[model samples]
Target: MDKDLNSIVQKALLGDKKALESVVEEVKDLIYNLSLKMLLFPEDAQDATQEILVRIITHLSTFQGKSTFKTWVYKVATNYLLTEKSKKDRKAKEVSFDEYANQIDTGQSAMIRYTNNEGEIGLLEEEVKVSCTHGLLHCLNPANRLIYVLGDVLDLNSKEAAEILEITPSSFRKQLSRSRERIKNFLTAKCGLVNPNNSCRCKRKIDFLIDSKMIDPHALRFANHTKRSIDMMQKIEFLDKTLSVFRSVPIIGAPNGIMKEVRQTINSITF
Candidate 1:
């Protein structure tokens, strides 16, 4: 931790509103991106962002600063999100998949293909765009998405994120793997972008853009496999026997019930 970080946190903990705001600004992107990836919806991401900051304010006094300030801050955010996830219903009504699909029409696809280079900075076309949302971020589920955001976007290692989320490193790896598998399958199947087998580079992405058709077989297979897998995973006898490690411990930051009020909350808080 930088020496000055301690001072900032100390002031924030003491209710210096500016100090608290500064802290919020410092970690805003991390919180927003993590929320976006985990919830896979724009509105949810916005809500999570606001809720996280409010949580930080509520818990600021309790922050002991034992570890790096960033880690400690993240730990608080993770705990708050986990608490929200365990709830039965959400503040915002859950959006049906049908409603979401209706928004991502083919005309939007043509626009995105020509405009956003999938949000990669240098890869953006000659004319830049104001990103309306994390369009691709919503492609994740609660389980696997965190790992991708923490590891890939934020550049945090598995161990650090695990520490923040309070899960074992191995569980982190498994979740990350599952998250990647699901996303890779989704991109290939849904948007028809990304072919993992053909080459390491994203040549397959172009194929999807050019062909304008869904050619991914795994999407069909996944649709079939998901139901049985969920049922099988729920059966204590088998799920416990196989997923012994991930089963026993409390899921430090299980998904936030993947909610809807999520949008309202984010819009309220994010700077």
Candidate 2:
């Protein structure tokens, strides 16, 4: 795919209209998924994806071929995400892992006693599970969060991920280890999905999540999409079974009308 993308990128740099559109089509989903994991909000992810695509198109001429086109795209996208001030403001709302865990435990007692008349509690449970896990990721600062997303969620190797982040391989491995251990320790102590003995269950938290407006039953985000099964994940011997919860998230696609919007942006560009 990178070989074909590199050829198309070359044509795109030379001002081929179809090649530009193909470039957008090929990388839109990748950018959107990465953005979604980073932002944890679908709307924010959509906006970031559009901006990143525009940056990629405008900077197409800067490609030096030192890396594959896909890796270059990741580098561009990660740079935008890392430095965006608005995104930094969003991260400001993040809570510490201990605070988040305490909230979950406390909320379990305040949970409204409601009945699942619509028979949708199952879906609601899934939403709570996904939302809580995504929220947990916010405990990490942006840099560490990016590392976790790249290494664990996206399954990028340390060397490849280091190149994208422009860090040494050893630094990347060390940071990834720290991030993974932090998450592993938290999940082991709190998440019932990761440890059956843990008291926190998704079903038990749904009422509180809904009552607190943490999740909207009417507007289901992550749960409504098709999720990747655990079996589909790469067989990495070192990956703990508990961490599969993050890898099993649904891969969100670019929003409708994105292609049209991207094409308009491309047409407006001089090259």
Candidate 3:
């Protein structure tokens, strides 16, 4: 933790109610996004974020200052997500890039309703990008999925990622490299976002997505409303379009009302 945040933690520990709430607010987005990516559904992510916050509150005093507070929070988070992963049946069907493309291609004639609202359309486009990229992450197993998210999407360094995962830097790097190559190769081969030669694009698939009920314009949940459209298309070199596509999607923000709900939950707890 930085000295300022460390001071906040000291105040929080001293039974300052506002300071404790500040601690929850400080890490809220980090925990929420981590759960969002790990769980792959907004409702599940919200639940996980609340649960993780409660765990943090329960164990806050045990934080020994051995690692930055952010790192420790992530450690608590990853452990919770891992345990959640283990409780489920491990076999999530892997959708190949080709399979995903074909699904869109075969469903094109299903009568997608075009909206006159440009903003809604743009939000839909962004929704597809984020959902697809997050789906790609899900194609990896839980461990590699978390590793790739930490090292690549979140841009944590090797030491920081290893600390969150409780692994040596070498091990984290190894998993991240393999995960990256696997995703890159998959996207390059089948995703039109990377290879212009391929026959899929977000605009072209909007019809199929609507027909399939994969996107609802009024209920768009993943599009980042705060940023401008131009900011969404991150520029990578033409040759590195796969990475560019991954980079282009904006970070999904927490839903409205979650922060207040979290604060209330934390305050209600005896701990």
Candidate 4:
């Protein structure tokens, strides 16, 4: 946290209504993006973001200044995501590496009769790549998924991520390493983006995904963004080149109108 946000937090704690709203504005993107990665759905991410923001406001006084406010916010968000009952209730069915590989392999013979324009094809391919990689994260249990998202995608250092996760830095590093290796192995074996010889190209999957209604050509979820997650990340030394495929995933903004909803919800609360 910077001096401005720290000062805002102080004012918010003193019953400054504008400062409270400022706090929400400042942290909403972090909370929202983390929720999206954890939940793998925009609607669920939005709902969880709202709930987490409310929790932060309700517990603002509990912040002891032991860590940066950003880290503290991460602690609150991760705790809710880890323990929330509805997360399990709403989670998509888990797919194993074998099952996913089979799914990709099953549709390889299909022809791309939909579009021939190179630009449109590229967009659809991007959608497939982003959607497929996000789905891959579900193969890991929630804990490991969170570990990967925090350590690799968000590029948080081991000590900070460990503090956020309430684990020792060594344990965090161990789990993150395992998660990275698992994802890297799977991608290298199956994804053309990571391995040129792999048969599972994003362009190859575009037709099947569209035909099956897994992707909407008009309403793309991940491909429309101008900035990828990699643009915001600092390069990790000795990272496997294969994992760069994940870093290519687009960084999506929180859904529109979320701040309005948050403001309304804040108004309803006494504090």
Q: In order, what is each prediction's RMSD in angstroms?
A: 14.0, 2.9, 3.1, 2.8
**Which model is ahead, 1 or 3, in terms of TM-score?**
3
Return the clash pairs for model 4, or none: none
State residue 156's C-alpha deviation in candidate 3, in Å.
0.9
* Model 4 poorest 10 in a row by lDDT: 229-238
- Among all candidates shown, the one with the greatest TM-score: 2
Query: How big is the positional error of residue 183 in model 2, measured in Å on the Cα after superposition?
Result: 0.3
Model 2 scores a C-alpha lDDT of 0.81
lDDT of 3 by residue, 1-271 (tens): 5777888988877777788888887887889898877777777787778878888877888898999999999999999888964475244445665666566466443223676577776676677767767677777878888998888778899999999998999999998999989888887776666777866566666777777787776676577543532244545444566666665555556666677766776677663
List the candidates ranked by TM-score, beginning with the highest: 2, 4, 3, 1
Global local distance difference test of model 1: 0.47
Across 1-271, the per-residue lDDT of candidate 4 in tens digits comes to 5789999999998888899999998898888888877777777888888888889988999999999999999999999988983445466566788888888786664457779897787777777777787888888888999999999988899999999999999999999999888888888888775677887767778777888898999988777763443332235333565667666555566676778877886687676
| TM-score-superior candidate, 1 or 2 | 2
Worst window of 10 by summed lDDT in candidate 2: 228-237
Candidate 3 Cα lDDT to native:
0.74
Collision pairs in model 2: none
Candidate 1 residues lying further than 4 Å off, grouped into runs, are 1-3, 85-140, 185-271
**Order the candidates by lDDT, highest first — what do you get?**
2, 4, 3, 1
In model 1, state the lDDT of residue 97: 36
Any idea how many clashes model 4 has? Answer: 0
- lDDT winner between candidates 2 and 4: 2
